[model samples]
Target: MARVERDPTGDVCPAFEQPEFQAVRDSMKPNPPGEPRSEEEVLRMLRDSWKAGHDKRVEDWNMQVQRDREERERLEREQEQQDEEQAERPEGEGQKIEEDNGKKTKKVYFDENIAVGDTITDRPASYTLNKLKLIEYIELFYFTPDGCRKAQKESRSTASTETWGITQMEGEVVGLQPISALKLSKFVKPDTELSWEEVMLGRHAMIQEMMKLGDEVWPVKVVEAFNTMYAALDAHPMRRQEHGSEATVKYQAHVRREWYDRQARKQGFNIGVINETLLRSMRDEIIDKKKTESLREVSVQGFQKNLYSFRLPNPYPSILSE
Candidate 1:
């Protein structure tokens, strides 16, 4: 079956219709807090947003890239100087110097990788396992009655889950996320009513439902569950209005620090003990989970971008010759 690419000329921003360009385009767009934009408004906003700050953002990005390059070069020079100094030291002292130099080199490489959003994969097996466990813990905590606190904090209640759908003069922004277990079990049974006391614990309910469906679809369902939950949280009015789009961006330093502090308190670990290395590893796990969630949707923008990379050969060569 041929997949039709959505024409960006309709209502939405052209950049938005193309998922591949979204990461870059997001910063280009101006998003006023709590203001829901309809498709019609998106095109207008896109133009205004680009005209307003696109050049400034490009300049800023170039400056930052230059700074990172300089920093990396500086570290390389320091490592080279240390390497030269090691030769003059005693054998045992020289060995220690070599180890210290190795550590510095590794730090430089790791930091650069993180800055560029590259995946970190050099952790020990135990560390990887612990990272998985932590992610599972955070997700499990979500399905509990305690998870309803997120909704309550935003002033939402069971009485009107429908109102979670935010509307403005422009139109609907994001629709309400169903209160179903894993956002998939409504087909099997009615969606669980949203109430702190009577809410179905998603972890338990998911387990029960998974048994009926068997192992084939379990992975997809789990990823879908996480995605649904995350989308709902991100769409919350408080997150939208106050925090704006960057509130929970996984790569941001402040967001990482916040998550570390929150998780340390919840998991009964000392904040000092959970260092940046471990936090980065855990974030990698989360990134992997998000990747799983996104695999189901094919990006039309990718195909379109490829098509535009080079011109196609003319099918009617005789007409061209004429």
Candidate 2:
């Protein structure tokens, strides 16, 4: 008997008309009505989604690392050129100084720590105290070697030429007001004599009082007493540690991201939202509670994402409807 091929025009395609086709297709389709997904199936879907996100994050991190590597190389080349130029330059040609009656006073630039007994002979200074009353907490903002190069690269891309050709200056220093002095002012009454011993002993009491009072309200007398006591403390040689143009700033083992937020508040700025990389870095940082408490601001949420999810529309709507 001679074999005959199936007709081209048929109710269903030959491929779809096979007995095994429907079973294979149905198996690949989503769970049917009245049927719930198994735990294994749900877990599989979740794992797939997580894997997709993980892969994306890893890709981003790798790209960033590559960019960082390139930036470092560029910076190293620039630094070598700068060192050569520096060597050729005259000793004091570009030196900046302050002259008082023909006597050169040492100028302590940024990142240099200023402690008590460090006299500022410069007339018409911004601060009231000619000599530092307290060392306080030195807020140091730093960029790592890689971070500095990255920042420079970004600056260049943004048309900022100020940081151009700069390589070695990795950080800045900000001297904040003394927390102890601020607390001591709280305990001061108009007629109450300020004792150093009491100031040390009542440190805890001062904290309690601050918490109880809520917002700080410094009276005129209290302010005057604070200034007096602060000045007196500075004058006392016994209380003075190593002073002058010394880099005495030592940061805690691990700093909290909230510390920057608190500083931002003091400086009158908002932290707003940060990127995933920064958010992860912040979480890893562990700050001392004592430092946070001294900062005097309640913790606020950091690096929170506001997100929503929805299913994508099917592309073949006409076919699906049919």
Residues forming the 10-long window of minimal summed lDDT in candidate 1: 181-190
Candidate 1's residue-wise lDDT over 161-195, tens digit each? 53233212122543343342112111121122222
Tens-digit per-residue lDDT, 189-285, candidate 2:
2112223333333322222232333334323443344334333333444333332101111111112234334544664222222223542333333
Task: Assess candidate 2 and give its lDDT.
Answer: 0.36
Query: Against the hidden true structure, what lDDT does model 1 obtain?
Result: 0.43
Ten residues in a row with the worst lDDT in model 2? 244-253
Candidate of highest lDDT: 1
Q: Which stretches of candidate 2 lie over 4 Å from their true place?
A: 1-34, 90-322
Residue 247 lDDT, candidate 1, scale 0-100: 30
